[model samples]
Target: MKDAQKPDHVSLNTLIMRLREGQFVIPDFQREFEWKPWDIKELMRSIFLDYYIGSLLLWKGKQENFNALSCERIYGYPKGNGNPVHIVLDGQQRLTAMYYAFLAPDVNLPNRANRALYFVHVDKFMAEEYDDAFNYDWLTRRWSKIIDNPEVQYEQHIFPLAIMGAGGWELPNWVQGYEQFWKNRTQEAEEAGDADAIEMAAKSTENAHLFGEHLKGITEQYQVAYIELDQDLAVDKVCDIFTQINSKGIRLDAFDLINALLKPKGLQLKHMWRAAASRLEFVETEKMNVYILQVMSILRQSYCSPKYLYFLLPGQEKPVRDPDGTRRKEVLITDAQDFEGRWHNAVDALQAAIKLLQHPHEFAAISSKYLPYVSILPVFASIQAHIKTIQASQRLDAQRKARHWYWASVFTNRYSGSVESTSARDFMDMKAWLQDDNAEPPLITEFKTRFKTLEFRKETKRGTSVYNGLFNLLVLMGARDWMSGNVTLADDLDDHHIVPKKWGAEHLQGKVIDTILNRTPLSAETNRHVISDRLPNQYLPDLIAENGEAAVRSILESHCISPAALAILLRDPFTAEDFEEFIAERQRTFQEAIETLLVKERLDLPVQLRELDEQIEQIELGLRKVIVAVLQADSQYELPSHILRNVKERIQRAAKKNAALDGDYYDTLEGKMEFCDLRELHDAIKTKALWPQFQPRFVNKETLNIKFGQLAELRNAIRHSRSADEITRKEGEAAILWFAKVLK
Candidate 1:
């Protein structure tokens, strides 16, 4: 009945030797080695930085212990004569990672295709850039050359970590050799009288010696703590010991820590989480529990990182800025009653947010997987709660604005990183924006800029925000089932290739065929049975015959495939060229849909006006390219004198006022071209000196004037953020189409 737990430590040098000799074995019940290359690289970094990597649990092994529980040699350990003395109960991942990295095993890491070699960037290590110092790469032919060549490794200032397991004289010899190598280069540079090369080589030599000593010191002196169990302990007792030790050692995130902190206040955060868990089960994320607290924090103090979440505990006071813009202290939760009330309110708001998100006509995030940004949930829910408190009539307008913000956040990836500050700022801005027309969140302007150039042709991944946003757009568009020709539930649809992947692989070599532009949500049955492994031309003709062209085209249009794109799809012997054209046409369709649906003004414009607007944008863009080319050829890329005095000066003034406009000359010029109406383009073209260079592109100044005047009238009306009258739309359509054709 003696207590079996004993504390122990081992120098890293001895530990590496033991691992190399296979003296310690892993228990068979242990999980498989799953550390990625990055994870292994991080461990190396921690060891080099002398950070504590936590304690290992070892059970003293005997014949009975081995017989009771099976054991295996550490993964990738070479066969050795050394006998196993201990069973690893914990730290298998760390040990295996060390074995893989220090030993540089011929075997690959788990789930990896190629063997990996780990290296320390000596310069980075010496400079204390620990995060960038440790690295690993597949032992490909290119890397093999670098690994085998000492000169290349030294030139790159990378020292391979595998030499540690070589034992005894190997590492010291490498250190000495590395220093001498750089010293020789330094001497050569001095002989050549190359000041820069001498300085560089001298630094390398110094780094070499310093890094060698530091690494050697770490290997010899670094201590790994462990808990040793007596050999006589029962297997059941060992299991219990492991469970207790591991459970205690597990790190607590903000939610778990806050839960523990709240228990003494007579508030059971765990019980509350259990009750609210079912409500948030719709989203497939473990962070939902933490998100509830974040929502509460965001609602209270407009900040929700772990630091702010601590203030939500009972009796915790956080500083706040009032609605009237006065700073004050506010107790986030006064007591258990107030704490519970806020918690439930936050949970209820999140539930309401999820309902709106999954609504087909709203964000159309029918499933958690298709939801654009889970990180946006705190702000989303907080804003939803804010909307409810406003007047009922105003709530609808407020929700419309909120929907715009949500889509903007998703498409622009605004909430992807450092969500705490972003959520706080956005929540405050959105509140202001909802109450006043002039107070628009900066994210709206960002989305306008980013969305204009968002290349759907490169969005090939399912998990990306843009990819998911596009799929959700399809859901909102009421993308119909291809086979049934009926609008289908988003849950029942899976994003499938418009052009079968099998055909693209065969015919469209080197083409990116899986872009969202070439994919749409379709029923699984339709993908398998109807469109199975066939080109769109092969299947669509049959669909058109069955459902008739009108009905089938309507279904395709719902998926954002226009008639022009359909024609490209229906092209016989659909070539890669056809695929490119189809994607281009669909890109335009999707872009238009986003503008009409998400980025539209408060008042909807006529479809003809929207189409005319798109046409004008394309025509002006093409005209700018022509103008830039002509100007570059004529003025050697210099801004024309008139433009420099007028448009350039005006833009520079604007950029001075708005920091967002600040950039280099060419950037400012591009911004000028993008923002300037048809008037500026006309002025540049009609200028006395630049007229001849632009004359060949147009018939004459008279013709140019007529077209420019037509476009200018409509552009002014649309760019003013209002719907243009019918006469302006008609004239603009004619002029835009003419210019679009001329530009093409």
Candidate 2:
């Protein structure tokens, strides 16, 4: 195609006039509206001093045509009647400022009138007659001339508006004063009716003409470049011109501008992501912007361009036009949608995976080398999706399976250095393995089988080998949350030596001190005050004081350390038998807990699926209820009768089907009431909706009863009154509790 023609060079007046008319529109994807008042002022000053600014670059593409500019895209453009003419993009900030100044009446322009006009002081001009005659008061907006005679006070002031008529020119302060001086002499003679009056009029007219001529000369000498683009010009060409001409002498990064070009179409998606990011910030206030951006970039598969990820979403990429001219350029609508959907799914999976990693005890032991890979959420989402497809109880299996795959993938990809690839082929292979039913080694099953082999078994002075193993597990689990912050090393923190570190020489049998089995996690602060060697009488009291009596009791019951064992410990202080027994029991419990947690996490699939389904149903039901309520209002209240009737019918049917039953069921085999009517319908609905698919597998009834009481209070508030204030408070409280449970 022939290159689009550039605009003929035009004068400032012509350019300003064209701008005043509505022939131009700024593309919505242009960079954020940014121009300080002083910046506008400086531009005006430069124009006033230099007479011309510079040229503008433009592009001419069809409105809907999708094409890549040289790596530097300016902004997104809407389809136009003819081919789109993009501002190749010089003078964007300048033209935008001018456009706003002329068109937007409410725009807060400095000085109120002619924001483009700047003042020069009378002191700038010095001439014998002009010096004494001219008086310029900028603050009061007046220009005046003083009569020569000291006794007579005759003020002759010139207003800027009067001096600059329709086709006007600016005059220097000196010329303005000289013109006023001649006019004053003319007026004096005219009043006195002397020969001088006629003489002064001629002098005054000549002087005024001379001043006008000088102003016109200055206006003619000033110039600026104006480049117009034809409808077919590419944006990259303009950006190159901009890079060459920009006074800063620095070139714009090509990728940055290309990213900008994609922005407009991505606004909706950006807003959605931002909203989610905002919620993350709400949960944790520090450096959330950075985290959100990092998360977004990884999910979008453009982490390398972290700053521009928001703009260059895959969904925003434009399609290239065919060189053969057989097909016109058009948006790849389906491709964009698919890309966005996949990205969103990845985000969802990552969010689910992080919930498991947030546990302080479990996550603290994870390693940092695999942090970044594990943190990538898209990988997690793909794994989750694959696992769900293969597992019969997918919804319940999704989170746990997702967690497993997350860690497994991290281990394979990051630690082994065998799985990481920009092509994602390796990750995809793993995903396929998990999804395949007939595969010889099912991905999850194989992962479990290898986990034992890969598991760290060597003990170190730092801590157990299990810590290293768990670190690797965290990466595979897609635990980005654990990636942040420093780990609480057992040495740095209070980790009790279950068999005291300071065992007597006789009891130790010359064994080295830093045994892994002897230590267990404890609060650092509590460890110091508790002391290493406790006297016989003080041991039980010291343990109780620090860990609480209940913890001590549990420890005593679980370990079953006999009186004889205690007596031996009192005598020798660090007997091998006690240490052996305690370490063995503690390690077993620890291993069992982790194993059970993993299994329970995976097994709880059905419950979570049901809960999610129930939640969706409840939301639909609530919306229906709202519609019914609106319809049931009296016709006099401005509701249409037919609509109301339809809504009422739907609600009535829903109510009859036990929509209001709140998912609570009571058994009554005989003629007896089996459940209390405590108005807990709303609580029941929320509980049913929120309850996790995987139970902890160890429920404390007392804790459950306490939670039930809190639920009862909330139910009472909902049932007793629907007042706006009461409803809002109850809703807020319920939301807080619900979120707390999720975090727990």
Q: Which candidate is the best by TM-score?
A: 1
Give the CA lDDT, 0 to 100, for residue 609 in model 1: 57
- lDDT by residue (1-744, candidate 1, tens digit) is 775767556999999998887778887777888887899889998888766576677899997787678888888876544588889998899999998888887887788788999999899888778888888888889998997887788788888999888887988888888999999999999999999999999999999988887887789878776777898988999877667656775433567557766767898888999999999888988788999999998888877866678778889756565778575777878998998999999999999999989887777888888887888898999999989999987886687788788888888988778888889899999989988975776678777667878999989888788999999988877788999877676667789998988887887755578899989988888999899998888899999898899999888998999999999888897888888899999989988888877886422345555666667778888888887778667544454566556766655555543466456753645555765556777888888777877788786789889888888888778745545778877887788877877787
Best candidate (score: lDDT) = 1
Per-model TM values vs. the true structure: 0.55, 0.31
Per residue, candidate 2 scores C-alpha lDDT tens digits across 291-366 of 3333344444423232223233443333233667342333322344654565455455545544434443433333
Q: After the best TM-score superposition of candidate 1, give how far the Cα of residue 63 lies from its true spot, in angstroms.
A: 25
> Each prediction's Cα lDDT score?
0.82, 0.40
Kindly give the stretch of ten consecutive residues in candidate 1 with the minimal lDDT sum. 601-610
lDDT for 25 in candidate 1 is 85
Candidate 1 at 741: error in angstroms? 20
TM-score of 2: 0.31
